[model samples]
Target: MQIDAHQHYWDPARGDYGWLTPDLAALYRRFGPADLAPLRERAGIARTVVVQAAPTVDETRYLLGLARDDDSIAGVVGWVPLLDREAPALIAELARDAKFKGVRPMLQDLPDDDWIANPALAPAIEALIAHELAFDALVFARHIDALQSFASRYPSLRIVVDHGAKPPIVEGPAGWQPWADRIAKLARLPHVHCKLSGLATEAAPRWTEATLRPYVDHLLASFGPDRLMWGSDWPVLNLNGDYLLWHSIATTLLDVLTDAQRDAIFGGNAAAFYRLEV
Candidate 1:
């Protein structure tokens, strides 16, 4: 089953997406399953994992409801306030739904870069590990040290690095070493996974394959196909490119690999990581 593992759906009317501002003109409107179905069909993606766009539990529940009915949505990586003292209870409550496959605490939005390393958050992390749910890490390069520490503390927890940790693409290939070093360090942990998603938005205007190939190659070398997965990043991807564009570039980057390796990066790894029924 071909899975676009990290897409999002949101309603501007919901008024909960604090980050969905007028500055992001293209993404300020509503995006629903109907809009995505055709794109997925065109891309030949049979299933997708809808991830959270807002940090509110209300939004998470909204996505869960969507997952319950949409056969195309294999699972959801929703959000909960992991730093909250009641996080474990909230995680337990949400996990009761078979469609609630994992949790993501919009760490990138949080002011503190070390938010994931808090000892106070241990119970919540442990709860996720106990439940065998995935943790979708929404972070940037600055959070790498904390992520490494967290991965060490919870050796069994399943973690997927979103957007290749949002590399400094605007700065060009010369600026890749710091992010590459950190990614290499994170990939050393067997429990962690990385996504080839969202990088198109990070590039300079009219970016080319040459702009992303370096970062993609570094990640492929670090984690290998079995530990890596691909995601459309969808509406947000519309900022710089579209599903087809990203897919085309990603496919080109993986073209040198054996078919099995390419299949693993595109679909198999996502199905296994998210425990999707597809």
Candidate 2:
């Protein structure tokens, strides 16, 4: 049940990915299930959850198609305008499709505190939960309070905290104290889980396990093994290093934990958290 719980796919020329332009033009790499398959084989990843990168339902449906056709992709987490009046309809529409396991709104760009608290987002969120869907919190440290609010409001609905609350370790973990405190608060919420995926990318460029140790340790301690999962973040991690580099960093970091804890961090937790079919 080794699941890379958070990854995305996109055909840049085919659709509107507002975040795929300009400064990131170099990252417009052509990728899909075919590109990831070899990497999965090398890394021993039996399953993957293709998370949403596009801002439209078309991308969600596309990934669903991939899940139907590609064995590596066991589940999908996509995007939806949480505050849109059409959210419920949108969720219902995607629900019938059967591959979309959840939704994520890219709250990272939104103002820290109010993004997830949007008043009009309830209908869609409720619809998602009713349909047995999950929500991936793509938020930053400043938004930790809002994340807490979100988890409290939707206690029964599962929520995954992507990127370990996105601590700014480049400035030292101390700078992330308030955010860490808030994250610990969110961890206490039985519904919330954290992904141990992108910690290296968040640290200084020449990052190593020692440099990344604090953040990883804090999260595992805060979220606990049962609620923690791992993700590759993949091509995005190309920003830090190649896939093997990311894998090596994760492996070295977990060397000190027990086998069961390591298993949960790498696969077990993702299987349970995302309910992937392994």
Candidate 3:
């Protein structure tokens, strides 16, 4: 089963997406399963792991409600106020729904870079492991060290670094060292995985496959095919490129690997990592 492991569905009218502003003209609108269905069909994608766009619990429930009715949506990576005292209860409640596959803390947007490494969030982390849910880390290169520390602290937690830590591809090969080194260190943990998504948006607007090859190659080297999964990143993807373009580029980049290895990166890894029903 070919799975787009990370994607999103959002309605701006609901007024919860603080980052989805009018400035990002192309994506400042509602995007749901209907809009993505045809693209998925074209890409031979059987299912998708719809991730949360807004940080509110209301939005998480909204995505879960959508997943309940849509078979195309295999699971959802929602958000909870992890810092709150009631986080464990909220996580338990969300986990009651089979489609609630994981949680993403939006670490990149938070002011504290060390937030994930904080000891206070232990209860919430433990709750996720106890419930058998994964953790989708929405971070950047800056948070890799903290992420590594957190992953080490909770060895049982199944964590996937969303968008390969949103690498600095736009900065070109010259700026690749520390980010590459940091990612390699993070990948040393067996519990940590990564998604091959959102790189186009991080590259130049007219980015070619060559512009992204080095970063993609580094991720493959660091995490290996078994630890990597492909994601469309969708509407946010529209800011730089479309679903088909990103899909085609990713496919070409993985052509060097054997069919089984490519299959793992395309779908198997995501299914195993997210614990998706498909």
Candidate 4:
């Protein structure tokens, strides 16, 4: 079964998204399974992991409700205060819910960009490992080195790098080298994987396959087939392209690989990486 490994949902009524209010009007609208189904059906995506857009347990609970309402939501990667003193208890509580596949701390929002490398954060990573939960490292270019350090330190913890380091395809890869270098280093860690999503939004407004090839090729080469996954990064990816656009891009992009390699990138890797039985 094909899986759109990354996506999200939110209710404006629950709480206002500080990042979306006043501007970014198009993105400010709410998107639940009702918004996802037709797009997903057109994309031939059978399952998905609805990720958290905010940083709180309430977001996790909200996603859990979405998952329960929609069978296609195969898993969920929600947010929690990973650095909290009750990290273990919080994770334990979230663990009781099967749909809660993992937790993301929204590293970009943290005061210190290198929040992943903080020694105090090790307990959180350890707790995830113990709970058999995947940790989605939502990071930007500058945070790559610190992320690499965290991956190396906790080799047992499953870490999936979201958005291929969020490279600047608009800048034509000058900053990509260092990001690629870190991913190469990260690839050596058997527990690490890369998410092949959100790139269309990373490029110039009118970018085509040629413009994204360099970055896509780099990530495929760095992580290879065994560790790379296909994700839609829906709603967020709509910032640049829709689900159909991402599907077309991914299907065409993986055409050069063998069928098995293509299968892993499309869904096999996600099923294995996220431990989703489907």
**Best lDDT among the predictions, by candidate number:** 3
Task: Give RMSD to native, each candidate.
Answer: 1.0, 1.7, 0.8, 1.3
Residues 2-101, candidate 4: write the lDDT tens digits: 8899988887667835676747766777889989899888878899988888877887888898888889998999887877889888888888888888
| Model 3 per-residue lDDT at 54 | 89
lDDT of 3 at 276: 90
Structural similarity to truth (TM-score) of each candidate: 0.98, 0.94, 0.98, 0.96
Counting only residues 3 or more apart in sequence or on different chains, how many pairs clash (N, Cα, C under 3 Å) in candidate 3? 0
lDDT of 1 by residue, 103-142 (tens): 9888888888887877998888888987779999988888
Q: Write the per-residue lDDT of candidate 2 for residues 1-278, one digit (tens) a residue.
A: 57788776777886577777657754686679888888887887888888888777788887898889988888899888777788899888887765678898888866546867876788888898898899998888788887888789988899999999788888884667877788888898888999887776677788877888888888888988788888888777777766777777787877888888888888888888777778
Better of 1 and 4 by lDDT: 1
Model 1, residue 35: distance off in Å is 0.6
Candidate 2 lDDT score at position 45: 82
Which candidate leads the pack in TM-score?
Answer: 3
